[model samples]
Target chain A: MGPPWWQAKFRGCGYRITIAREVILNTLAKTEDHLSAEDIYNHIHTKHPNIGLTTIYRTLDVLTNLGLVYRFDFGDKRARYELAEGPKGAHHHHHLVCTGCNRVVDYTDFIDAEVRLLQEIEQVLSKKYGFKITNHLIQFYGLCSRCQADG
Target chain B: MGPPWWQAKFRGCGYRITIAREVILNTLAKTEDHLSAEDIYNHIHTKHPNIGLTTIYRTLDVLTNLGLVYRFDFGDKRARYELAEGPKGAHHHHHLVCTGCNRVVDYTDFIDAEVRLLQEIEQVLSKKYGFKITNHLIQFYGLCSRCQADG
Candidate 1:
């Protein structure tokens, strides 16, 4: 509608507004699920048949460095990318990855108790290890209902 | 002196034991840190010069499929391996990955409250999403003290 996160970030950083980068970022914005570079290429291949796989990977690298995208590793060989939350935004989402079916569920329902527990953990680690933890990715691997019934 | 996890699992499942598999499992058991397949191969390559990278990967696949080892993707390209907690054991550890320095800290000091919070989250997710939760991996990403200071 107005300006996507990537556009604002690129403008602030003085980076060029290239077509390839725009297309990749737009594809990510439209995705409901976290996607790998291959997945992105496939999604845009019909419309942007000229875009090569290498271009997609390189653009993702640039977007990640610009802090417009967050890359996650879900025990799969490939890395999945999602839009970075806005400035000062809480990275509060957790992923539930089904081990049996490889389906990922993004969980945003953080109860107060769970949030307090994580804050405490961060405080402890910061004091004990002297590390300032900025973000956390928690993934619970399990079987979905269908897989559970099948197993 | 006693049989390790891989040995028992293989024996129970009637799978053949090979030198490559044994070496990889033993290497993982001896380390307190997670290691990639290349790291494992490099550690044992001098003694077992005949072992090929292909063999190491195939053996890891077999061990992983048997539920004898755990595979982790730390937002790095390669997958890291660790021995699975024994049947009666608890793999209650999490990790802190330093984005600036590429350092990984294994955080194992899980308190009762933290454990309880995770249990509650699992229960809530299972009830709402119908997922059969099994295992979890939690990683906090940030700059280490030195990295933060340097930045």
Candidate 2:
């Protein structure tokens, strides 16, 4: 319908849009779940044979640094990435990951209270430990019904 | 003084206590915060040179599997480990990490309402997605006062 969600984000963040960047962004845009860098790289490589794994890594890093994407780990060896530009635009959210099938479902309903608590904890830790807190991630791991059924 | 907290846990769980396991457990026990595998390896190596990195990996896996330790990612490249045998034990507590120095502070106090809400979210996700929810991890990140002062 309209320009894809990530395109608008790249524009808003003043990120230069290139074919490779577009491909990567589009890949993440279509995914409702988290994708490993390798997953994104393999998918893009099929359509754009010239795209290097390094390019995928670089693009992902740039997007993460720009706060247009979120990075996560679910006890898997590799890290995963997801578009941070939500349906509402520039929103923050957490995830519930089904350990059975590795599906990630986003939840933004509790963000305000979550953020407030996070800030309070950060304050307490800073005062108590002399440690600097930068960013954080919260993930819930469990089984989806399909997996639960099998189990 | 007395046996470190984890020593009791190993005995309580009926896990075989090995030399390397004790070193790993005690290393984590002596710390007041989280430590990466390499951190534990380095500290243990000074006293136990024959302790292979592979053993550290193996020991960590065993500890995690037995619920003797907890594993988490603090946006760090390496996985961090902490003793799970705390005042709140494994499942009931969350984490506070200082982004400044990579210190992890345990927070056992939790609002019951928040816990209930999380369980509700878990149930909803389980039903809607066919996923089974096992456990969750929540960490708050910010600058500790020492880092704030240094900055």
Candidate 1's docking class is medium
> Model 2, range B13-80, lDDT digits (tens) per residue?
77777899989988887786678888898999988998988989999998987777888786666788
Model 1 has a DockQ score of 0.69
What digit string (tens of lDDT, one per residue) describes model 1 on residues B37-139?
8998899999999999999898888888888788877656678887777655446577888888777888876556666778888988998899988877777
lDDT per residue for candidate 2 within A44-98, as digits (tens), equals 8878999988999999999887777877786567889878766764457788877
Q: Which of the numbered candidates is closest to the native, going by highest TM-score?
A: 1
What's the C-alpha lDDT at position B100 in model 1?
85
* Top of the candidates by lDDT: 1
